[model samples]
Target: MGAEAILEKIRQNAEEEAAALRRQGEERAAAAAEKIRAEAAADAEALLESARRSAEELSRREDLMTGLEARKNALAARRAVVDEAFSEAHRMLLALPAERWEALISRLVLEASETGEEVLEVPASDREKYENGLLERLNAALERSGRKGKLTLAGAPGKMEGGFRLVGPVYDVDCSFEMLLSLVREENEREIARLLYPETRAAGE
Candidate 1:
């Protein structure tokens, strides 16, 4: 072959080699770019999933808090109702009659007699009636019990709130209007609450 032809062939071969290297580099770069793009897409998907879970959890928590607040409001309403009922009951108890009061006292005296020695302390709003009949009835109760105890009537009458206090030296029995009402209120507080505020019963319970 001629020297120039040989040289030309050599130059062409060199150019082809350079062109192949450039193409390989380009292909590798494209492949790397595709891989990076796929990785970025996967990362984005994971982030979106995480965000969705967080949002769901927040929603659940909000629902729970809302329920709790509703229950608290219901409970507060129930408590108000119970309080009002107790107040009314106390009022009625205070309004009971003298005869009723005397009967209650007699019964209490009898109960006291069962335990031990009995002394009755009677308070009547009507001092004249107390002086007239209260002592006599209480003494009769003691006599029926087959035991004797002194009866002391509060000197001042009618001005005091209704009820009697029976003391047996050591143990004391209270049958006053206020005391009886308070005892009943404790037992029936829930019932009263339900009657006054039916809607709040579930929350209160």
Candidate 2:
């Protein structure tokens, strides 16, 4: 072949090689771009899922907190109602007639006397009742119970609303109205709650 023909052939071969290289590069770039897009889509989906889970968890916690707060408020209200009921009962007991109180006092003294020789501390407001044969009746009751102890009135009047305190040699017995009511309340708290709030039992059921 001639020199010019050979050169022309070489130029044609070079052009074909360059075209092949360009096509290969374009294909590689397209593949890389597609891979990046797929990875980005997967990352975006994962982020969205994480956000949804976080939101659900937060909502659940808020709901639990709200329920707890509601229960606390309800318990406080119930306690207030129970306290008010006990207060009213105390007032009624304190408003009893003088004769009724005298009878109650005699019974309480007899029940509270341990050795029968205890100083009976009466309320300062009702000291006259004890001076009028009340001590005699208490001693008679103690005699019937087969206990040997002389009962006497305390020189210092007791500070109380009602009821008496028997000051014994070793220990003192408090039969005061306030103390008695408190004892009764503590002992029968559950029963009182059931009576006052029927809904509590119903809820338990």
Candidate 3:
């Protein structure tokens, strides 16, 4: 062959080799780009799943708090009702006949005769029953004790409840309805609160 023809053939082969190398490089770059795109898609999906899970957890917590608040309010309302009912019942019991008052007075006058001729400061509403039934009992107790025979009734007005207050020369004894009510309330406060607010009581305990 001529020298020019051989040189031309050599140049054509070199060009074809260069084209193949370029094609291979382009394919490699496309493969790398596809891998990077897949990695980015996976990362975005993971982030979205994490966000969804957080929102669901928050919703559940909110629902739980709402239910707890509702229960607390309902318990408070029930406690109020129970307190009112108890108060009414206590008042009604206090307004009964003076049978209990006469018994209490008999006990007090007996004790008083031992010390001195003690006068009782009783409720004005019970004066009739006291004069009728309690006076004879008081005199008998005084005779038994061999003490002075003067069980005077106080002219001062007091509670209408069926209890008495005895005041002697040196000492005094209070047996009023108010005093009894206060003692009862103090003793039952914890039980009442627990019964009314069981859930809160458990948490506190």
Cα distance off (Å), candidate 2, residue 182:
0.8
Query: Model 1, range 1-205, lDDT digits (tens) per residue?
Result: 1222222222223222212222223464355335533433333333223223433444444446557776565455445534544455455445546665455545545543433344445445445665787677767666666766456664444232555555544445554555444433343334443443444554766
Off by over 4 Å in 1: 1-77, 114-119, 122-126, 154-160, 188-205
- Give the clashing pairs for model 3: none
Compared with the true structure, what per-residue lDDT tens digits does model 3 show for residues 1-205? 1222222222222222212222223464355335533433333333223223433344344446567677665555555544554455356446544664355445544643434366667778777866776766687677777866567788885654645665655445554555434333343455445555555565987
Query: In terms of TM-score, which candidate is strongest?
Result: 2
The per-model lDDT (C-alpha) reads: 0.45, 0.55, 0.48
TM-score of each candidate structure, all chains considered together? 0.48, 0.54, 0.51
lDDT of 2 by residue, 1-205 (tens): 1222222222233222212222223464355335533433333332223223433344444446557676565445545545554565556556657776566666666655667788988888777877887778778888998876489999999987777777877656666767655543443445445533445666998
Q: After superposition, how far is residue 32 of candidate 3 from its true place, in Å?
A: 94
| Highest-lDDT candidate | 2
Lowest lDDT sum, 10 consecutive residues, model 2, at 14-23
